[model samples]
Target: MLPLAAGPPFGPEHTMILEQAATALTLARLTSSPAWDRRAHSSVLLDLLHWRYRSRTEARLRAEALGLPTTGHRLVPVVVDHPGAPSADGVALTDHLASELLSSGVKALVGDLAEGRSGLLLALARASAWQPVVERIARELRAAFGPDVVVAVGPGVTELGQVTRSFREAEEVADAIGPASRDRPFHVASDIGLPELLYSLRDDVRLQKYVEQQLGRLVQHDARHGSDLLDTLRAYLDAAGNKSIAAKHVGLSRQAFYQRLHTIERLLGTDLESGAQRTQLHVAVTALESLGPPAELG
Candidate 1:
């Protein structure tokens, strides 16, 4: 089995960790006997991941209280979230996630965040291959919760004092990634991309107007004529302005594809091959997708 992280702790416990985690989730869900239990059945994770403790002794005490095995390793903070305040079902889901991680011998603690989010503190004994571990857990999370659940994995910290910073990193990743499907359910702080940036800008009205302006012409063309120039433009841009590749993707010869590209350029009044125009279209397309299908394309 791969080590939880890349460094020292590797082997023996790797394969069964995910299975154990799944079992833990199942057991936790079964024990969800109460509804709307806001008492934070597990809040030590909040203290561990939010604020710094005055001393190592204090941190250790809190970790122990949360059933985290923090003696020989520094814990990695992982945060998962869904939209809106968590209902009883959501809480049960979070509890199951925490339990599964702990059961997998992950030396972890689980707690509910103020909103509809959950925090986890995991002890990975100096292992450097933690990315795979996070990815594995993420797959399980997506499978269990569908596409809406997002997992943000923080960098590993060797000291208790640094854990809150790691948690903060996880928080940023979770926010940037937003609600996701299983194909891309989790991300790290370092992986923030244009899509994530667009997601964060979803509330800005100006952003919406900007998207409408950039691609509105083609959208309207498609609506009016049953044409697919908008989709063709999307493919062209996505292909990085490579004519041959985009042509092949759109199932057209180079000549036909060039004609379509020319038509799109005339319609949009922008050079498809120009980097500036491509960037604008890219952002607009990303924004449109993020905002959901427009009520009126134009």
Candidate 2:
């Protein structure tokens, strides 16, 4: 017969370990004075993450504040600005975003409000290789909320202290995209182009007047007759004068498309064949779309 063990299987030993863990937790509570549960703990961590992303002062202190797993830098800040989403507050949006990112195999530290953008800070294996991830994240967020979301990525940095620049760059990108802000959807500091530049000047008085002068008749026509002259003109210009292509897009036959195009030329009293005229019409359509509903215009 084998000798009997000193106690039941893992009885006192397990009990002792549990008691030690409990005591340690109690001591920790005394030290921090708060036993952070799930929601509270998450909120606190997010707050710290926001602080670190916004702070450029001391690297060592920021790292210490962020705790483990984020101690190493090489961080890239991504901002998903969903200003047009009908969500109530920043907290709900941030929570949903954090969950989506985690399920997509990206470990993100989310901050509710950072420079008017929902902050998603993460460290990637390759610092300079984060664009595709940003695009995918934007798509996922748009699916979660709605399509009017813009994602801006900051330049990569080797130190946590340098991440604030990334955050600021992202903010600038979100602001610069303006009308195309909804169209571009994803922005990187280095990728801005003519569309973003033109859209950024949407509030220019002359530009607003130009848009109205060019497209206002089409707008009133659409509203009055329930016709689609504005959409037809936009599609026609978008097709670069390819009547068949524009017709296909607008679901009109070639004859019908030409008739509509002729009508548009007559309505605007400008030749659409000239490249300069085409350019002006296209820009005007874009500006009007950016101005939103006619009610807002009124």
Instruction: Please identify model 1 stretches exceeding 4 Å from their true place.
Output: 1-42, 47-60, 69-71, 82-91, 127-129, 178-186, 253-256, 294-298
Please provide, for model 1 over 1-298, each residue's C-alpha lDDT reduced to its tens digit, 9 standing for 90 to 100: 9667667765545434554456446445644553322233345566666574455656655455435666668677888886653343554667667656757877666667757787877777684567777788878776766667888888887777788888888887777774432257577766787888788777789988998899888888788888888778888889988989988998999998899889888988898778998988988988887777654544
Local distance difference test, per candidate? 0.72, 0.66
* Prediction 1 global C-alpha lDDT: 0.72
lDDT of 2 by residue, 63-121 (tens): 33333235444567777776756653443566667666667777556654543457767
Question: Highest TM-score among the candidates is held by which one?
Answer: 1
TM-scores for all candidates: the values are 0.71, 0.62
Give the 10-residue window scoring lowest on summed lDDT in candidate 2. Answer: 33-42
